[model samples]
Target: MSKILIIEDDLSIGEMMTMYLYEEGYEVKRAENGTQGEQIFQTFIPDVVVLDIMLPDIDGMKLCSIFRTGSTVPILMVSAKSEVTDRVRGLQTGADDYLCKPFSMREFAARIQALLRRSQSFPTPVHETPAGHPIRLDFEKRCLYVNNKVVETTFSEFEIMRLFWQNEGRVYSREELLNKVRGFDTYVTERAIDVHIANLRKKIEADPKDPKHIKTVWGVGYKFLPDPSLS
Candidate 1:
């Protein structure tokens, strides 16, 4: 089973998310604040994290930065702040995706599902983003889809996606992914993957501000989180 940790100061919101996640069949854990959240992150090592930016202690962006230095666990950032810079800052700080306040529970579920699907590549060949509907990967054509339409993608990102689609739910540390995507012959650094992911998000996601798929696993690496229910 996939583990998910919720780090939010709002008890009501945290509990609500926990309930939804449990219903969705994820192993869910909760923390009231940043410190407690970090503790859970250390002890539980969840596959995905739902983090609120406006915590009472230790702001979410800074915490995200700290987490990014080490692990690559998928992080979904929730915040009341809807500013463009705020979202971009969160991404720059290493958050995989950001959600603004007052969101629909149904879309929330879909977003989480998309993030999970993006994290783990599997037989389910297509994925979704907030801006566009679904991104279908064509292994034979080396092409991607936005709904039914095709989108241009770089070769490097395509290679990464192929690897991710094959690995699915398994965690691929930076070194591991580099070796796999770049190949031993290419001698590519993990940072290369980072650059590629950033660019890929720009191309595939309709609203990069709130990405529906492709998330960051702070401190460790990135993942293609697929919806666990589909598994």
Candidate 2:
């Protein structure tokens, strides 16, 4: 019963997407333009947004960027523009995935399924000790705990974090991560990487803005710099 929002200018296309998602058993909401889209987001709070770049008011890029300022809800940009730069721009603007227009319904369906799968995954964290304290990552328990509380993480996020946790101080490029993060290697626009990293930042770091653990490289990639003093 996941809720999804579709912000598209084309009525036919919007309805088409809505029909398909509905058939797939997802609750769908539609917005004709960016302005209306934002309003709907405030009220409905969708699990994901299928946003189009070109809109009547306040372009999708601007809207998505604004949405990222507060929520980490996954965004998938669907547009007719097939340019790599456009895709990169969408990702840079905080989109989690991108799909070119005229795409088949089957592929679109698969993408939604994949995104949902990744979004809902939560691993049993690795604990630091048998006492079940929430202050450490217990390798045996496979859970993360902070302040005697369990730290939630997705399956992929946990693996990426574990690598950094073990290494302590090391950088991993997007390419390296594509291989490490599984079949995600095929989708190399960096949107998925950015989103996953964004998710990790929210889950593990004390302050996602000034992250002390996961640091971003200006033109390269991301690194793990855990405080040596931490438990």
How high is the CA lDDT of each candidate model?
0.70, 0.74
Which whole-number lDDT from 0 to 100 does residue 110 have in model 1?
62
Highest TM-score scorer: 2
How do the residues 98-161 of candidate 2 rate in per-residue lDDT, one tens digit apiece?
Answer: 8898888887777676666655654555534335322366554555666666665534455566
* Each prediction's TM-score versus the true structure: 0.56, 0.67
CA RMSD (A), model 2: 6.4
Alpha-carbon RMSD to native, per candidate: 16.0, 6.4
Model 1, 44-124: lDDT tens digits are 998888889999999998888677556656677888898876876665566656678787766666656655665565354
Off by over 4 Å in 2: 124-176, 179-223, 228-231
User: What would the TM-score be for candidate 2 when compared with the true structure?
Assistant: 0.67
